[model samples]
Target: MALVKVFSGSEILAQSLKVRIEAAGVNVIVKNNIQSSNMAGFGSLGQAVEVFIEDKDKEKAAQAIEDFKMGN
Candidate 1:
């Protein structure tokens, strides 16, 4: 199964998105999470968190992300 990038953002937002996507039955992998974990004061502001999902589930993942953005 090919993986596709669904979202990229701050660690907190990425984690939140991960949870939402998983709840929708889509698998998620997070990149740069370790980097965010090691960030110190003022270091996290520039750190990026990336979220990936199976290519087939991209649409569902995107919907979940958009719903999260809309506070749904």
Candidate 2:
């Protein structure tokens, strides 16, 4: 299955999103994991973490994230 980027944020936030999406039965992968370790620059502690899921599950994954953000 093809993967599509759904969100991007800090490592912690990406991991949190991953857990939530997976809990909803949607598989997720985190990209740029190495970038999360480098805090050399100012305001760069979070780094760039990309979250991806199957293309077919894009809508559901997005809704899950929205619901999560809405505290649903």
Candidate 3:
């Protein structure tokens, strides 16, 4: 299945969103470019953490992300 990016933010926010999305029964993949950059001795310059999910779970994950943002 193809993967689709659903969210991009700080590392902490990405992890938080991952939990909420998984609770909605959608699997998550977190890509943390900030961490990679730090490991490579380059400081982050942008929103480097991203959350991704299978394209099939896009709708469900989107709702979960919205709810999380809404403080639900």
Candidate 4:
């Protein structure tokens, strides 16, 4: 799979997305070079990162990510 987006906040969510996209192609491109969001001063930040895989896997990845966040 190819790297698509790089983000942080929760690797679990990222892993779930990668799992769902395994059937397709593309993945959350997390690397040392990925620019991180500045939330140090922010009160609450949900889902610090967002990724997009193949169009076909988009739906599956989304659901799996949600489930993962829910401890599924």
* RMSD of candidates 1 onward, in order: 3.4, 3.6, 1.2, 6.5
Q: How many residue pairs clash in all the candidates, one count each?
A: 0, 0, 0, 0
C-alpha TM-score for every candidate: 0.73, 0.69, 0.87, 0.36
lDDT of 3 by residue, 1-72 (tens): 999988888888889889999999998999999989989999897789999999999887878988878888
lDDT of 1 at 69: 84
Candidate 2 structure quality by residue, lDDT tens digits, 5-63: 87787777788888899988998888865554454443443457888899999877777
* Best prediction by TM-score: 3
Maximum-lDDT candidate? 3
Candidate 2 local distance difference test against the native: 0.78
Worst 10 residues of 3 by lDDT: 59-68
Query: Tens-digit lDDT track for model 1 on 44-65?
Result: 5454788889999877777788
Better of 3 and 4 by lDDT: 3
What is candidate 2's CA lDDT for residue 58?
80
Error of 3 at 67 (Å): 0.3
Residue 22, candidate 2: alpha-carbon lDDT: 95
What ranges in model 1 sit over 4 Å off? 33-47
Q: Output the better candidate (2/3) by lDDT.
A: 3
On a 0 to 100 scale, what is the lDDT of residue 18 in model 3? Answer: 95
Please report, in order, the local distance difference test score of every candidate based on alpha carbons: 0.82, 0.78, 0.89, 0.49
Encode model 4's per-residue lDDT on 1-72: one tens digit a residue: 433343355556665556655544435443321234343443435655555554454554665556655676
Candidate 3 has an lDDT of 0.89
Clashing pairs in 4: none
Poorly placed runs, candidate 4 (over 4 Å): 1-7, 10-13, 23-28, 32-51
- Worst lDDT run of 10 residues, candidate 4, spans 30-39
